[model samples]
Target chain A: MGKYRPGRRALTGATIVAAASLGLAACSSSGSDDSPSDGASAAGGSDVELRLAWWGSDSRHSATQEVIDAFEEANSGITVVGEFSDWGGYWDKLATATAGGNAPDVIQMDQLYLASYAEREVLSNLADYSALDMSHLGDSVLGMGQVDGAQYAMPISTTSFTLLVNQDVLDELGLTLPDTDAWTWDELGEFASSVTEASSGDVVGIGPMNNEYSLQLWARQHGEALFTDGNVSISEDGLASYFQLALDWAQSGAGAPADQYSEQAALTLDQSDFATGKQAMSFTQSTQIAAYTTASNGANLVPVKIPTEDANATPYAYLKPGMYWSLSSQSKHPEEAAQLIDFLVNDPAATSIIGTERGLPANPDTVEQLSGNLSPEETKAVEYTETLDPILGDAPEIVPNGASDTDPLIQRYLLEVMFEQSSPADAAASFISELQSSIDAA
Target chain B: MSLKELNALAANRSARRRSGGKADTRDNRAALGFLSPWMLGIVGITLGPLLYSLYLSFTNYNLLQSPSWVGLDNYERMFGDERLHQALKVTFTYVIVSVPLQLAVALGLALALDRGMRGLAFYRSAFYLPSLLGGSVAIAVLWRLVFGASGLFNVILGLIGIESSQSWISNPDTALWTIILLHVWTFGSPMVIFLAGLRQIPRAYYEAAATDGANVWWRFRHITMPLLTPIVFFNVVLAIINSFSNFTQAYVVSGGTGGPADSTLFYTLYLYQEGFGNFRMGYAAAMAWLLVLIIGAVTAINFWLSKRWVHYDD
Candidate 1:
């Protein structure tokens, strides 16, 4: 005990401090460390080794492993080595690997970097591959992965922007929220203020505007497209109104405190305002109820239609592909890669393992199969996704090629407004120009 | 050696080379043979990238495309780039404020630990612990937890009747300071160096001064300070250059957005964001060159100004 006691507690202190940064250092270097001669092998031979990389959660990783196991059992001779990363560092790893021509066989693609990677020809066009199958998926689902009429990726799931109501917070306060389906943004704000008042400032109504989706939805509501025809089309006024809602909420005591909001902006889901039970509601993706349920310390959250200006607008929301599977242009085994992706999206055995972990499956057939057996939180995600089908407008435009940099830009302006360093109008004006230039440059 | 001594040695080497022919030539050939691997490594790995990046600094390369020549365009943009200016300002503040404070703390600790005391190894390793872990992402996350709203920091504040719930690391006014504090907290490496310098200082001078009725302050000022100037200069140069290159601490601490409003936007973090995050490799290269120039100029100034105050035995 004495020998162990010397380092036992001291090691814990050092371990806690040295942990997270090494993960990133390892990830950034892995691209260079991997065999540069990758993808030059596995030419339709038995026991083909393929690398499949994606950014996701622990649950998603396990589910993906299960899918891979199922796929391997069903189709022998092909092996998939999985590469996973958190979302923050994923693109850096993917881009560096893809640029070095050592990209994994199957690459998980995001809408932000999708067009850029597609235009760069780093992703293989699925249309040219005969082994791939997308016939079961609808035209919209197919179009989600198309850039300028070329299918470069296969959409895995569909999701919509939504308002997640934390029933546990309301129950704790002995209060009820307003009708989420037809409420206006202002009415939502008022309810938030009431929650703040009832809880004596312990909790707020809505979380901070850290993510980009809320702003996009607001722009569309005001008859502006965030990006149209490869350019930023949202007006300064439309954007300011979005920022204004955030500022107004903070000042009105209907939102998380400015510092708390800013802090929450960069925190993990488990530490988020809504997840930590410090907020009654959150504007997030429809598929998030499952994740939020887990993140929120036993907070029973329900995903519902987001509040609008009039509430009667058809397509009060818009659906977007949650993620896509892009076959690497460098992949020597594109046929095998496509078969694996096809299995993940359309096959019942794979869908059973996946459930709503990656949002509702893009294929209607898989979505139907998942509905009866999903976990309660996953069911909430599927049910909420179903409720949006009638009201959701045409699938939103794919993020522009160069607009991947705009997320940080949006957060910057959002912070500026929240901090009172800049007015909403001023921040919006700067953001618009910056956004336009980045898109133009890209 | 001083610059004058270095020049004299070079002159001496050349004279020896001119007079002593065969034996020197044989030695040179052997030296070249021994140096071949390192020369190859430098050329292949280090020098190649350095020269390529210098060329890339003038082009418009985004890692995905052919680097089109756009002479001075990247440099021209850096002049007007507000975010780049902000990043420069943040980096300069971090270096200026943290380096002296860090040196002072390191010097203080080194002096205190210089005295033979009980459990010296334990104390030394414990103090050196933060230096090892401070720059890591885990420590930054733990830092956030410590200074978070309703975190231990606020709880400590509460105990002293200072009622506040602001997350120190998240507040724009205080975020930079928190990072600077982290920088200062990693004084272990410098402290160890200072301790080594202290050990190298002879006790004869202090003993002589003590016999002359000199006080601790007088002895430290006249004898110890002069002897330690070289180490102090070395530490200053290293610390300044290191502070400029610091990325991980700020990148991880600020969650890579350089926020609560670009307050912790260290220059290397910005360069990394441009090169890797934004994929503007050309601009990043230009920024990297600019950083090299800044560090070079500052180091040159340090060497030039060292003539006035840096003491040497010669």
Candidate 2:
């Protein structure tokens, strides 16, 4: 019995060991199998496959995939794999990829992060590739990509920050849209209050001002910039007035109440108070007029210039780069990557497929070609851009490395003031100090 | 005849021992073979990253560029970081408030369910459903719908003529409490543990106590409570750890910014913001290690204190 016991135990142990080893082997072997395919594709060998990644909606993704198919058809050897996600997930995934030294060959970049990536040298200089066409892009638009005199990204499109007004809400309240072109900040506040009072508070006159872009425009109107040469340059007084304006609007019942405003602020684009016709007006990017109009269920959403303190003297608008296409510094086939970007910019077929999903194309030829096919909302945005071209202020300086931190800091302070946890002056002071420290740390 | 049989038995034992050594060696090899996968996982997946993060905590790794050694700078920065203090305070408040409330609810339900009842399995599953779905993003989204300005809660209030327009989750004063309520709603796991612990308390003890004229509360206090201490300790430790590391509900409800003035900024969420949002991975790694140490210390204290209050039948 003792002799048999030892043998049985040994056999049982062997079986368990063999089973576990096989399980682990199965896991590791499968993992390793995936790496070689990625490695081979990234090596720019005979196949010359490239991975391109971007963040956008479903329509944008389908449009971009169509463009990729076209690129692949034109250059048979070069197959471009598309990776896309919504806005929030994109940055995290990109950061992880870049950290692991496995970033996609081509990437969609944002202005807020343009300088950050450029300073980190994660982006390859587009100027280094003469094969890519830059002659089609004008200096002002092209300059958006220049950091320290090296072009690390190329502008895909341009958009301006604007006020989107819901005409239906105004009509319901028996109020006409205010004159956006000549209205001062004070007059705008009164106009919002008048609408709210006229509507008996069923509809708010405006949503809360939570956007940092609005603050930037306000600062620019006061002859200051949010950031200058990599440090926060907006003064405390400028920031305080901006906060005070929002506070006054809220207190006067022009904007949604603080708690309701925060709830609205937390919602997605389609769920916004303005989009749902709960508010008559909200700050929005010009490129988003189409989306807002759609979300509003055919409500007459119109794009108007942001109201300024003095529109004639202080031109607070600029043609901001909607987004940029960049090549990763770790890309193996940068020349091919540049060629694809050039195609995306210059090819009318590709532009037709992309079709202002990214906003108006940066290339003038593509814009002119697509002029006859513009949606009514797109036409309004284009005309608005044309009117502002002569009067727009200088583009704000490229955002600094730590500018991402500023958005949350601004939101926190905005909430603090709205909740009466702190006075506007105190919140503004705290915001400036925190923003400065963030920038300094970067 | 007896002596010769005993001698033969001894000889057989000695022979078996000599051969058993060889079998033991084989068994050891087999056992090692089975353990190899788990050992490999520990070394490759867990230990590898843990050690790397420990090293990263001492360096200036920004996820974009190669790390540079900056010994103790990241840790030192935590001492002066106001946001860190805010996150810590928020997490502790959440833990302190949610743990006891959850355990009490769990224990109450557990005791009631311990009474013999009809459809016991169905009730158990129904009660356990919230815990199954507690940390999910869907529940968080549903929470927003239930607590928004025009949400179900306000609608109910309106029907009763209360006429309030406050967005409960967005109000700074009430936002953290909304999350805590969500935490307390998921008491199923601890309730199940408590139910099992109650069953283990000898029914005969209660019977004897009844003879002594003890009421339901009195019997529960002396007999059931004493026996359930170990389970309560287990639940408390787990509840504290879970609350400290909670991220999904807070992240989803606050729209990933921990907003309305950072009121719901759980420590894990703040660490995530620093690591992923701000790209300050080194600082985040330090925060991660600090969280680990805090949880570890708390758990150790819990165990040490368990000796006094936790009763064991054996």
Q: What is the C-alpha lDDT of each candidate?
A: 0.81, 0.82
Off by over 4 Å in 1: A1-31, A36-45, B1-26, B117-119
Q: Could you tell me the lDDT of residue B97 within candidate 1?
A: 98
TM-score of chain A of 1: 0.89
Candidate 2 chain A has its poorest 10 consecutive residues by lDDT at A27-36
Judging by DockQ against the true structure, name the best candidate.
2
Off by over 4 Å in 2: A1-36, A39-48, B1-20, B159-161
Q: Which 10 successive residues of model 2 chain B have the least lDDT summed?
A: B305-314
- For model 1, how does the per-residue alpha-carbon lDDT over A293-404 read when each residue is reduced to its tens digit? 8777557888877777876665647777888999988888888988888888878898898888777788888877877788988878777777776677876688888788
How would you encode candidate 2's per-residue C-alpha lDDT over B1-314 as one tens digit per residue? 69899999899868867888776678779999999999998788666677788888998888999888999999999998988998999999999999999999999999999997988889889999999999899999999989998799999999999998889999999999999999999999989988887777767788999999999999989888977786777688778777878888999999887878889988988998888788889999889889877877877687678778876554
As for candidate 1, its clashing pairs are: none
TM-scores for chain B, in order?
0.91, 0.92
